[model samples]
Target: MTVTSAASEPGDRRGAFLLLGAIILVWGINWPVMKVGLGSIPPFWFGGLRLLLGSISLFLVAAFRGRLTLPALADWPVVATVGLVQMAGFLALVNIALLHVPAGRSAVLCYTTPLWVAPGAALFLGETLSRRKLAGLALGLAGLLILFEPGSFDWSNRPLLLGNAFLLGAALLWALTILHIRGHRWHGSALDLAPWQQLTGALPLLAVAFLVEGGPDAIDWKWSTLLVLAYNGPIASGFAYWAAVAVTRRLPALTSSLAFLAVPVMGLTASAVALGEHPQPALLLGFLLILIGLVLVEYKPRKPAA
Candidate 1:
């Protein structure tokens, strides 16, 4: 498969890795930053505000590059659907979940998108579902069970349970979005439509915030809160989203997903350092299992010469 991207040089694995590393770092740190932002704002409004800002930032870049134009009419449906599912749905659900779950643990659960994507690709796109990948899936499930079992998480804690469930839902929605992107026959460059999609997704969220949460003034914007929003919007959502999409386009789905696993690991570390979240035994065990599973899924053995 050829990966055609503005940033990609032909046969450039090193460039891809560098891009992936930057994404993991930005996104990983953004987890704790998001938690901090939510401390000062409600979930829906926080998401809306970030998207709105990010969209504007991205539009500026697009316009500067002379690439800002309306999406072709035929592409609007795909853009709208992707905007809703990927930006609005995924962010809203994850933000709600973060209200209950700690940032590190939330990151871990949310990245389980790959487990769904691998199978979905096989079923719908005719990608190979090899035995290694199945084993990896089993291992990842074992990790989830270890993380979520009654022995690990107190079932009596309703918020935690609900939060975890929401994260899982977000992961599934994200997986669906991935499949959609993979299948989309782009009428224009995906990069060109990215800001528009972000803008489109932000509209409903802003509407909901006004209708349900009262209005934009509801946000009690501390300087720290404003700072986090700046980081989340321009760096995380704007640059990071585009970088991620570019990197994913340049790699295989499973490989892209596996590389994304770094986000949670960095999130975990950042949460521990920045948010002072303690790691639990079950979380450690689950993290290890999930890491192993990802490695298995991405591993490709070489054939010997005859």
Candidate 2:
């Protein structure tokens, strides 16, 4: 019985790890997939559709599990904030940015979330900003400078800059969201919050997509585009979001951040192999520094107990 229990523990952990890996793979590939999808639909429309589908799927799952709960009237404001930040602010900008910047380049820029989170956490949550984290932030910012050189600036490329800016803004918003969720008086598992947030947040986007993109008729349908859309909606947004919330409960925040290190690298590598985009040397160096900074930020030293 002892041996069986020990073996089962490892198996369980491995399953969790595999699930996390799958989430990263799907999300990493999603960068290029969004680029492909955007060719056939406008950014707001695509975001609206994806979130609509995701909301439906998540609601169905919640219903099936008997876990669906409507958001309280007071929580509407928080839901709206998350919706605007994650769906409208982040996805809309990223979708449009893909037209101007390579998918790989944009992915690198977006995953700079940890850099922003380190300081935000310190300021908002009273989390300590250790020397190591400060050093990491410096290194990561240096890398960003290399990636976004002065020569790369051009008004004609406004969309790309806008996208990068939106992603950075989204990261800050996400950090705030994290702070909000942790402190808010919600009465459910994180899984329960997922569908409510997606559905609630998608309302404005739905309206905008319909008004701007001529409803569903605007989409120039293609199998490739549809496949990407489905993947992002159901698998990436629906399942992956739940999985991440589940895993974070079992792992420390630092450990979770370490796990996500794989995401940006995989995103860039997959973009190169699948999309035939080549990253510049400076860009490569920038990613290296970002990775190093992430490690520094997440590394924790043991403290003496009172």
Candidate 3:
């Protein structure tokens, strides 16, 4: 569990909360950062390069802690699942969607993964589907409906529609990744395996970048552009990933879920501040509905007669 002692023993509950807060901040702001990066590079290249730097940063972290090692043979499947689906596919698609979608709104759409994950968990993980969960699902879908309401969304706008589709797809992919991670018995701590997964995810992405964007020539290389790119790597992806895993290993699940929900909220706020994105009334209402649903979903009722 060297996630490196994972350093995440229960005694460090305060530390875990601190890390969770950091994760929310970094990941939330990251939405606008990715959107900004797209201005300087094509989506695929932007995603690939950012991911590559993140992987390298992770590798360095593992090495510096003397915890660096190849993934355990048994861990490779989970690594590939996480790397390809969550790290590579989900992120790549999200970046592409940012090319068309506004950052704040896209943040709302992309975070719908938990709504999908609840049902999938019940079916696949043999978890109980409680009444609260059902209610949560209903409310979450209501939110989605509001966002997609005819009066609000211009479905006639193809690029916007496509961008929303991509974000939803990314959410689904992330849910699938989490389901797989849940089903798989772990042979290594998340920290130990994470760097390898990053590399596994990054290599194919760079290949795609090569074929699609054709080289480094397209990158803007401006100061603001490079600054965000650097931020995406070490701070957002690397440290955030590490901190999240460590916090997950330490904190109560419900606490983690409730805390993590701040990500989209922060994303919306950051988008407004950084990208000048003002939320429409419908979008804001939809966002509120989704947050309430998530709170319900993470609420665990008592076990009957246990």
Candidate 4:
């Protein structure tokens, strides 16, 4: 995936930074929230329900912000790409993969989308990959390796292997979405397009959920379950997705992607606290490398020629 901004440098770096932080927090915590949810709900149903809630909440928020509108015809391709590939395809695979893989591992694997995006951006979008950015990418990937703790990932187990494969597939879809987003000529704010994208993704998600999981009778909707589902909805999916799109649009793709590496670290820490899955000592080093990488990636971004 490419790290270049296909558009001009964002005028509002502060706002984009804040939104990026929000996205990281919501999605990082969602790792464990989802782990808990899947214990009681089937994967397909759980994914669909959460996305449906996301779409409704997003529409309300967009309307409240006076940004709600039908997507422009030019934006429809982006909408479909993000909605179907990023939201539905990625979430569905992640949810199913989470059934077999640990949440921390899943986060680490799925966030590897940047590895594919960096080269892609240079090739397809003509974004320059500076030496600093490339180094940051390498260090960040190293951190991911440490967090993943490859030795522990049971390559021999069929289910676990397949789950890992699913995560990589999700990452690919996400990379494609990112590339499309960077290259797209937007006619509206991320807020304006967010609800439509959610609606697009939600339709297929719900349809697939109904087909695969049958009726929702299998769901055990206890108080804990309801809370988990709610967190996954408006907070994690709707708001996080909106914020993520905003961040991607505003920041250098490399900068945003490297910063996003922080999510799995947060997820790892959160998983430890929420799920009682303690991190290995090596993961502490991984955390340091990732942050350093983020700093390096954002260091001295080139200014446009006057």
Best by TM-score: 3
State each model's CA lDDT, in order: 0.83, 0.74, 0.83, 0.79
* Model 3 vs. true fold: TM: 0.94
Steric clash pairs (candidate 3): none
Candidate 3 per-residue lDDT, tens place, 28-71, comes to 99889888888888777776777788889988988899988887
Q: For residue 179, give model 1's deviation from the true position in Å.
A: 1.3
lDDT of 1 at 281: 85
Model 3 stretches with alpha carbons more than 4 Å out: 1-8, 302-306
CA lDDT for candidate 1:
0.83
**For candidate 2, lDDT tens digit of each residue in 158-200?**
7667777766676666666656654566544556667767776
Model 2 clashing residue pairs (backbone): none
**Alpha carbon lDDT at 246, candidate 4:** 73
Clashes of each: 0, 0, 0, 6
Worst 10 residues of 1 by lDDT: 1-10
Clashes of 3: 0
Superposed model 1: Cα runs more than 4 Å off: 1-8, 11-17, 246-257, 300-306
For all predicted structures, in order, the TM-scores are 0.90, 0.89, 0.94, 0.82
Worst 10 residues of 3 by lDDT: 1-10
- Where model 2 places Cα greater than 4 Å from the true spot, the runs are 1-11, 73-77, 151-156, 304-306
Tell me which residue pairs clash in candidate 1: none
lDDT tens per residue, model 4, 215-258: 77778879999999889888887778777767877887667766
